[model samples]
Target: MEISTRRLKLLAILGYFLTGITGGVIIYGSEKMIVATKTPILIFMVWSGLVLVIVSLIGIYGVIKINFGYTVLSSFALVVVSITLINHLMYAIIKDRSEVESDRKVLKLWNRHMLMGRAMHKIQDRLDCCGIYGFQDYILNDKQVPVSCVSEELVSYIYKQLGCKEASLREYLFSRNFIIFSEFTSLLLNMITAVAGFKLCSRIDRGI
Candidate 1:
């Protein structure tokens, strides 16, 4: 019985450590886009990571104290985390699927929406990319290529030849894959933590 308790405690601690790492991964994946895009999904991703870390901390504390109430709370928190992660995962998949189709739409709306234009400029500047497909996108659209497309040196060779479309898409795909990986990892850990938590709660209740 003592051995079982020790094992359960160890499992909970390990889960907590992994969960913290998973949360950090998710946060790191989305942090940059949060300010640039101001998208709700990115904000939610950040919040989800924070919540997971907090819940894992609570779970670790519960396991250490052998407190049934805290253990139960942690189990419930896992359910919430699972739901959020599922939602986040689905959104990411959908966005990934539609990304190619959305390129033209983005280009069309580039000059129309002030917010989108600023966001595109920011992305171009940060990625050292030009218009959607290339600088020719501006030419084709009869629009002037912004200064963001070029380096400070203003040399022709230094000008960004890559398009913001490809650059941003590549970045988004990488972030999406990273977040998906973290979410799956977190969900798996959540299950382990939930099972271990419940069993520990039961053992504590039985005074074992």
Candidate 2:
């Protein structure tokens, strides 16, 4: 809603501190693993992620002292985190589907709809509304169901979360706002976190 400058600064500081701690842990763990395992790719990753984390940390200071600077930076940081979070969520959905049924309990009634087509068909019979597969994509009088349970959920989640109030997944995907800022904030935060962490970890690439 409406947050004052002071509130924003406080939020920024908390966000920065947590991000920094996590990034620090990642860097430390990676360093030790890199040294012990001698994995080239992993080593490089440590440095790259470290850099992003540090930049994010600096964004915190900028936000607190430099006025709206941190807000701008924090938006970017949010983007970064959003991207990674979306990626992970996708991965989870895929993983869940591959190993077991995609109908996780957490997904609620949606779970029953995915695994058992018959059950979904029955649900359609009960409700005047169209058949719900994941959240949207209702089976109409004439429509073919697509495969990929994980993809179904992913699209559905995005569509419902960012979609028009009444629009289905089909319509939500086409929303201009979703396309533009779908994951913008997350990408920014990811970059910020990485940059700040790298800056903080001086001994990373240079071997200090």
Candidate 3:
């Protein structure tokens, strides 16, 4: 069975488009879970996703134009993104998970961003939690426990027992691990498609 140059190009373009779409959806879905949790490592996931999408678009354009230069650029970008993503995943996997759940770290992160504060408020409200550690940790400027800390239900229940630190930590670790796996798989596929496309373009240019 023989494949034509045009068919190869089309397949390559499809690969890039599908990979890009998949990545966008994955990031969007994970954003809600990670939104409340602020950390330096999370920023790379956002930036790398954007870069992958851009490079995927470039790859599609290159396939359409039959331009090897564009294909090479896309391939190079994919390699860089793949390496960075792998490293990020390694760090996430190898790092001390307990340290990431520190009360002080969570509190500092909550204070760093107003958006994070809003996110945490929403999370706490939904989870019926008080603060990072407990109600005592919520004291600020003589302010009482936030409304979220109190259970809305009149029935007896332990609302204050659920702390944001543990909830956030669970969500963060789950989301991070999932993102790492997804991106790593997509990166490998995208790199293969990119390299194949580049070579096909070269062969076509040389009239092989």
* Model 3 steric clash pairs: none
Top of the candidates by lDDT: 1
Positional deviation of 27 in candidate 2, in angstroms? 0.3
Q: Candidate 1: misplaced stretches above 4 Å?
A: 1-3, 35-40, 87-91, 94-96, 100-105, 112-119, 139-144, 152-156
**lDDT of model 3, residue 15:** 80
lDDT per model, in order? 0.74, 0.43, 0.69
CA error at residue 160 for candidate 3, angstroms: 4.8
lDDT of 2 at 69: 45
Q: After superposition, how far is residue 23 of candidate 1 from its true place, in Å?
A: 1.1
User: lDDT tens string, model 1, 57-139?
Assistant: 88888888888898889878987788878887887887665365336535654665234445467667766777777877767
- Model 3 lowest lDDT segment of ten: 112-121
Which lDDT tens digits does candidate 2 get at residues 33-103?
43322333345446645754675567666654553444455555555555655664454444433212212
Clashes of 3: 0
Q: Per-prediction count of colliding residue pairs?
A: 0, 34, 0
What TM-score would candidate 2 get against the native? 0.37
lDDT tens per residue, model 3, 145-180: 666777777768645767777766676667666676
